[model samples]
Structure formats: structure tokens, C-alpha cells
Target: MKGNSSSLRVSLRLLSAGLVSEEVIKDDTKLVGGSGLSLCDSNDNSKKSETNKALRNHQVLLAAHLEEAAELAAMIQGLSWALKLVVKSIQFFCDDDSIILDYVTDKVAPPNESIVVAKLLKQLALLQTSLTSCQTLPLQRSDDDINSSSLIKLARDAIASQTTWHTNTEEYETCPDCYAHVSPRHKLEVRSGYFHPICFTCIRD
Candidate 1:
């Protein structure tokens, strides 16, 4: 749900007064056999509300072959989703320079041949319609920052737990992406072999 600009600003001010900081998080995982992706908001401490998904099958194949520009498209998709949850206009931080550059400059669209890129463009267009303001910036990872290390560990743990692909016959698992209980009908199995039980609403959007 996108918040009104005035209300969002006020809320941020209130939160800031209490020393409660919020950051929009975008992180990608390149594993041995597959990739794990997460887009979320980090509240103070290690607590996070995130949407985690894995790439598999055709999506994994497409991601594997994506050039730098195409990869940026994928990251944009994640960032768009994260922006929807924010009440206040905020800066988006990611490790990818190409994405930040394109977002900041409003660069040219990605090539038509990449289906994933097309989807990302569509998502961004929708996000623009709903958002009042947003800024994209780069995030540098450092080993010295305890907070950064903890976030990395938290993302790794989520990926580790949700990486396996499961079928409808399998037990129900809560989707990290939407934070909803997923039943078999809405479960999606990735080609990399991890079972991500996503809700229908998330899969659709």
C-alpha cells in the first residue's frame, strides 16, 4: 500500500523522533546452483519484513544469461515492490551501480528481446503511477559494519530455509515474500530445485 505523501512525511518524522529508522533493502544471491532474491524494509535491530523469492527453471536460465543492463531491470523489479510498502518517500539503496544510474537519470528502456526486462519496465511504470517521490542510490557492502553483516546473515538464513522447491503435496510454508501462509495451489517450484510457496496475489503482481 502506498501512503500519501503528507502522511508519510509525518510518520517518518514521528519515527525519527523515537529513533526508529527504516531502510529499503535490495539484495541478490548468487549460489552454486541457483540465485536467491530478497526485497524488504529493515527496521532497527535484526527484524525485517521481507519478500523473498528464488529464480528457477526458465527464469533462472534467463537470469544466468542476462547482461548487466538486463540484471539491472530485475533489480528494479525488486525495488518497485519494496517501494510499495513505504509510507514515506525514501531513498532506495542497492549494490548495483547500473540500476542506480538508470533510476537517477531516467535512462533509456531495456531492449525488447528480453522478456524479463519487459516485465520490469511494466512494473516500473505502474510504480511511477502510484509513487509520489523516490530516489535511488548505491550501497557499498563492508565487513566492518556489524549491522550490514547481520542483514547479510538474515538474508542468507531466509534463502537457506526457503530455497528448496516444493510441490502442492508438500507441507504448507509461509511465504517470506508476502508474509502469507501459502497453500499447495499457490506454490511455485523453481528449476534450481527450491520450493517457494508464494501466494497468488504476489505471483500475480
Candidate 2:
């Protein structure tokens, strides 16, 4: 469930106050210590009682949020099917170069997610070719996976193929025109399909 900004802010504050793991209080039992309601008295035990109950609710909320975060991280790292679903949401990032670099990399990929991972890597490499140098980055976050559906694409893509012995062709692979090495590899993308994949630099040149 999505939380409003105020809910999040309030939750963070309560968590900071060290009350996150407490169970939520049931609304049935409140302090009935005072007889005649009079605002003039400082010992309004009902008010203090109310405050305590509210605090517990906040604690339960914060604990739920933290649990969600841990669950997401675990799911992203553990399951391969979920990781595959993650690829659609993910994007690659390069340095501050004023260009949109996109390319295909069928380049003799493996059987598993490695093929998809290769596509992703090839795309990034294609992008980097446009600039002097750049780094490949994954924008999708593995910070929320309680449902285990959030980062499944990434997990699947991460394990497309098993890691094994490699030649310079596989590890420090790059376009023949430019010897620029790919930083983030093992993850490729095979989306939109391509006839002949070309690195961005090669295309521009």
C-alpha cells in the first residue's frame, strides 16, 4: 500500500524515537480515569493515554515499512524469475554526455538470462561509445520486494547464464573500432530486436 508524505514523515519520526517494533494498540481500551471532563486540569490522564496509543500505532506502521524494504532486497537477490521481470523497469545510465545512446548486442550470448543480460550490457556499451568514457548503472531499485514482484526482472536478467571461463572476447568485450571496455557486463538485453547491433560511438563515427 502506498503511504502519503505525511504518513511517511510521521513514521520516520516515530522510528527515530525508537518505537518501531511495538504492536499497535487496540482502540477498545482507553483511560477512563477522569470523571467530569474539565479542560482546566493538567492531569488529564486520558490525553496521556491517548498519546501512548497513537505512538504504538506509529510503531507498527514503521516496522511494516522496514520489513517491506528488507523483503524487496532479499527477493531481488534470491529469485531468478523475479529478476527477469525487473529488466523491463531497469535502465542504464552513462556520464554527462549530451547524447542518447541505444544499440543491440546479439554478440554470441549464452542460453540463460545471460542473453538478456548481454543485451542490457550491449545497450550500455553502445551508449558509452558516444562519449569519451562512461559507466553503466541500473536505475531500478531493489528496496521494496515484499510481493517479490518488484525486481524479478533484474534477478532473472542477472542469472540468464551461469558464470564460467571466458576469453578477452567475453570479459573486456568491446566494439572492434574502439577498444573501450564495458564496465557492467554479464547482463544483456534482447529487447525490440535488432538486425545488426552497433555501439553508439561506431554509429556516430
Candidate 3:
């Protein structure tokens, strides 16, 4: 009877181990069937949404920059190119078709002096442009100056003095690779910290 009792106890222990292993296997299978797939899908959707959001934001930024560039171009044409010919009619140099001819102001001036004044005005108006305020300094010279008394002289002096204001020097903004003066008139104007063109050529290396 004691031997039979020992044999029964060993059989019970073996059955218990088998039962525990079966339970553990069921739990692992349920986790794989239920939670694992859902977790993967959730993570994938999160990444997809994140990528979609980034793309939309990039598009919005690009559109805003394009609009800004268009405005700058229009402003340049409006203020800079508008001054190129004085009026809607005078577009080129040989335009001698009855635009207002300004006369000399100095009393008893020599012919050479008068000619020199005209040449000066042409030089001043070279790079003419007004600020964005849609209001520019009056083209007429101030009454404080002796040369301002004559309207013809003032107009001539204005066409010369008003247009010649240029941007900063070449040393303030030079291309690193080529060491050339980059034209500031293009889009992507980098005005940060004394204005320099951050060209793509500089970034290639």
C-alpha cells in the first residue's frame, strides 16, 4: 500500500507540470493573436500620421515663401524699374522724344558746367528704388539749398541723387566658394547678420 501511495503521488506531480505548461502556452498564444497585431498597427498609423503632418507643414512653408518672393519682385519692378525711364514712355537711352529738359541754375554759368550737371543727374538715378512705404522722398531738392530755387535744376539734381543709393559693399557679402559678389536681388535673400547669400553651391561640400 505504501508503494502504491508513492506511485500515485509521482503521477499527480507529473500531471500538475503538464497542466502548468498548457496554461502558459495558451497565455502566450492569446497575446500573439490579440495584442501583438494591434500594437503593430497602432505604431504604423502613428508614423504615417506623423509623416503626413510633416509633409503638409513643408508645403505650407513653401507656399508662403513663394508669395513673399513674388511680392519682392513686384516691389523691385514697381520702385526700381519704374525709375529707369522717368515715365511710361521713356524706356531707353535714345529716348529724346520731348521728355522735360532741365536747364542750368547757376547765374552766368559756363556751357561746360551745365553739361556736367546733366551728366551727374544721369549717374545718380542709376539704381533708383523707393522704400516699401509707397511714399518716397520728394524728387524736388529742398529749398534750403541754393540750387533748389529753380524747379528745372531740382528735378535734374533729384534724378541724379535719388537713384544712386546702393546696398552694402562686396566685402560684407561675398560668395565663399567663388569669392564673387552675389547679387542680392534674387529670391532667398539672406539678410541675417549684415546680409549674405547662403547659396546652394556653398553647401555642396
Which candidate tops lDDT? 1
lDDT of 3 by residue, 1-205 (tens): 0123222222110000000000011112110000000000111211110000001122222332332222222222223323332222111110122111122112222245334333333332333322211221122223212321232232222222211224565222244234543443332333333112444555443
| Candidate models: Cα lDDT each | 0.40, 0.24, 0.22
lDDT for model 2, on a 0 to 1 scale?
A: 0.24
Across 21-97, the per-residue lDDT of candidate 1 in tens digits comes to 11111232333121223332333222233343332324423443344323344344445544555544544444544
Runs of candidate 2 exceeding 4 Å displacement:
1-150, 161-164, 171-205
Compute the lDDT of residue 141 as modeled in candidate 1: 42
Each model's total of backbone clashes: 8, 30, 1
- Model 1 lDDT at residue 71: 37
* TM-score head-to-head 2 vs 3, winner: 2
Q: Report residue 85 deviation for candidate 1 (angstroms).
A: 3.9
Clash pairs, candidate 3, are: 124-160
Best candidate (score: TM-score): 1
Write down the TM-score of every candidate.
Answer: 0.42, 0.15, 0.15
lDDT, residue 151, candidate 2:
26
